[model samples]
Target: MMTSLFDQFASPTMLGIPLIVIAVMLPWTMFPSPTPQWVTNRVITIQMWLANRFTNQLMTPLSLGGHKWALLLTSLMLYLITINMLGLLPYTFTPTTQLSMNMGFAFPLWLATLIIGMRDQPTMSLGHLLPEGTPVPLIPALIVIETISLFIRPLALGVRLTANLTAGHLLIQLLATAVYVLLPLMPTVALLTAAVFFLLTLLEIAVALIQAYVFVLLLSLYLQENI
Candidate 1:
């Protein structure tokens, strides 16, 4: 029997147990632990440098109040980057591809930003629901629209990450299947498809990294508006 094209996305299982729990725990194990000594291993040193660079870039636009989010943002970026990149490897499951997982990440954090903004600057936070210099005729309609969009932020964030990764994985699987089937029947065409598949894999790797960065970047922007 032919297998389902989408079966690749099903969460892996072993002895009737889902592997997602393990997948979530796996990323943290990759990071090298830091030492108390002044000098450190190259791995830890490089990790710290990259992390600092990410925080510096992420926090530069925010006010002093937002700087406190540096640790949260940096940790999030690393967690996402590791999970996304690892998913590209064989025999791996990407938790981020699931909307539930993405929303779990998005909603709480997005809500946190909103809560911070409202707590710190209630007038400004509420003002975002209705912009300045609005005509009376458009006032009610604009308020409705803005309120809808504000709540839509977390949904958009969850969907964007899930959709992109799912689409890329689906396309990669389809192309690889085509190449495998045509290898004997049509050598030249199979060769072309194989080349395309190779290029597509590289693009997917970049997407994994870029999507992680964009996720964190948007969070930072949300925090900026609030704090």
Candidate 2:
């Protein structure tokens, strides 16, 4: 009768989310702190390696730009991948499955877009956001609409990842419950449910990566268009 933490609190809510928070954070306290032995975290190591490669290369301006961007994007992708895989473990809470956590990550991304875009080319950033040659009369209306869309990006990003992960997690939970119920009476049904649960695990892995790619790709598009 082995089960997981997810099986215990599949119907999560505001009240219970705190418990999940504690569960997720407990690892930080439980894991032995690293000594000042210059231990390298995987993401940090990758970032340093990429930075060194970029610095060493005699790249053209355009080539250098592409290399820098690719490295930056790859780092983001790796980060998301690591977090998503951590969620697949037993007794672990997937923070990304929570709306608040997803919003936390996504909002900063939108803010960076705004700050970077404006800093690099304020006139073009604000002006280019609207259509190239719209009449002055309609420009105000266009700006309002475009501004709303720009803000909505973070909201959309948060909801998309949270909703997808939440749904997949719930599906696995429900299937596991059904399997538990039918185990003695209908072993075949229970076995089928178990098989489906394994499949869902694989599917969740893909969803995690896909959502990360989507977030980064949309961001890259915004940067390219504005800057």
Best by lDDT: 1
Residue 85's C-alpha lDDT in candidate 2?
Answer: 70
| Runs with alpha carbons beyond 4 Å of true place in candidate 2 | 1-72, 133-139
For candidate 1, lDDT tens digit of each residue in 1-227? 88887787788899999999999999999999899999998999999999999899999899999999899889999999999999888778999999999999999999999999889899999999888999999999999999999999999999999999999999988898899999999999999999999999999999999999999999999998888
* Residue-by-residue lDDT tens digits, candidate 2, 1-227: 88774553343457555565554554444323334658867766775675466334312233333345665666566566666676777766677777787788778867876787688778888876598888999988998999898789889988998888778878877887788999999999899989998998899889887887787676666656555
* TM-score against native, each model: 0.97, 0.68
Clashing pairs in 2: none
Which lDDT value does model 2 have at 45?
Answer: 71
Lowest-scoring 10 consecutive residues by lDDT in candidate 1? 2-11
Badly placed stretches (over 4 Å) of model 1 are: none
